[model samples]
Target: MASQAESETGRPRYVPLCSSLLPLSRLTLIVHGPEHGHRIISPVEGCRRLYIRVNGIVQGVGFRPFVYRIAVRTGLAGFVRNLGDAGVEIEVEGPAGDVKSFLSALRDEAPPLAEIAELRVEERPPTGEKEFRILASRDGGEGGGTIPPDIATCDRCLADIDDPKSRYCGYWATSCTDCGPRFTVIGALP
Candidate 1:
């Protein structure tokens, strides 16, 4: 006899019965019941990989660096990069628990300038990667994503402008990761 259990997801699970309950007279016992689902459990425990695509005001606002820092701090291994004009793409691989935590932090701790519109996640096979890296921007897509509006100079940039020793000292075009020119700077070809 085997005890039945239900997981938190309301799925039925099985647990082994104590050996004392099984008498030597019974070499094998078979129990048949209604089919619940086709879920198969894996015996091995290890890390999982996830591919995440984030759409919206995720570019030109230090989103890539934000993700890279988060991944490294969380002990994850993978890469993050700009997806042309389609937002950003990230591939993260780590222990299942760590990966989940990283994902949560990614959403909660996004850069101040980032406005995430949509986030899609998909499972992927582990790539056995040991370190996380920031990749170069990729091009060629539908390119219909929203372009962020030009942001006013932030306090840091203002301070940099005021500091005599700063490279941007007294510079009128001072800018930084969180604040700078954006859509307004581009001009169409005639």
Candidate 2:
């Protein structure tokens, strides 16, 4: 028997049934009373997942570290990795709101040296991941994207070079993610 309660105007009210037992698709079903049945209830919120691909000058520009920092700050659990010369790939899973916020910050708060040509976002099933981390780089087939150009030394690196006690003091090639040469350096096979 359905439980009944007194309403404000002396009317009898029937308690709504629990919808969790039903399938997610059928959660909107209405259990009508003898008369009108216009009462609506909110659906349960669920976790969300997103697969993001960022292209153009993302590699070697502190993009992965930037993403990791944002994910940690936003309390998201996922992984970020370099997609070869193509760009970077990210998988973020968390509450829907947090996921959205993370995505927004990823675009708006990117590193200064990172040049984002395009950003693609796809929805996926939540994997219930517990932590966010940086993954190793992966090859993404042929036709790689443009390589990042050499950038001038940043203020921080300059400061480090000027500091007499710093290890990199007076070092000619001293640089960091935010400022460094990408393709200008010559290398020999070991």
Candidate 3:
């Protein structure tokens, strides 16, 4: 008889009864309970794919390059692209741990100019992608992302400006993905 692995909802889910249980990652057992809540246990093993759509001031803020850098660093495969609604779409597939890491980095290390109003992630089957890539922009539903406003000079840019040897020294318009006028420079929505 299979033992029970209960979820947060107290639903009885079945699992092999073993004296020594497998690590949480290996257990396909109960991760969450109830459709209303998350799994109570279990972390899906093997390759996992996540389709992430980030909304807000994501366009014209160097958000795509930031996503690309994190995706590559985490050893994930997939693509990141800009949406017509001033949002970003990222699809990443790799080991579950790596994918999770990518997600965390994406949230915690977003560009300074990007004010993420909403981030939605959905799990999907692997697509067997060879490498991470940046795809072209796509049209999206109406009225989602916010128009990015001009950002103040960040510490990094300030440091560069203060550096006597730097090329951007004393250059007032100096800006990168992180800080500077964004919405002001845009001719139109991307």
lDDT of each: 0.76, 0.75, 0.75
Q: Give the local distance difference test score of model 3.
A: 0.75
Candidate 1 residue runs with Cα over 4 Å from true position: 1-44, 187-190
Candidate 1 per-residue lDDT over residues 1-190, each given as its tens digit = 4457777978665643322234424413343445634333322124678999998888878899999998998888899988767589999987777789999988999888889998999998766677889998888544777777899999999999999999999999999878989888756311
Best by lDDT: 1
User: What TM-score against the true fold does each predicted structure earn?
Assistant: 0.73, 0.73, 0.68
> Which of candidates 2 and 3 reaches a greater TM-score?
2
Q: Please provide, for model 3 over 1-190, each residue's C-alpha lDDT reduced to its tens digit, 9 standing for 90 to 100.
A: 2455766878766544221223434555443335526443324335688899888888878888898999889888889998777778899987777788998898899876678888999988765566889998888655556777777888889988999999999988887766778678777754
Q: Report the candidate with higher lDDT, 1 versus 3.
A: 1
Once superposed on the true structure, which residue ranges of model 2 sit more than 4 Å away at CA? 1-44, 186-190
Error of 2 at 105 (Å): 1.0
Q: Which pairs of residues have clashing backbones in candidate 2?
A: none
Residue 28 displacement in candidate 1 (angstroms)? 28
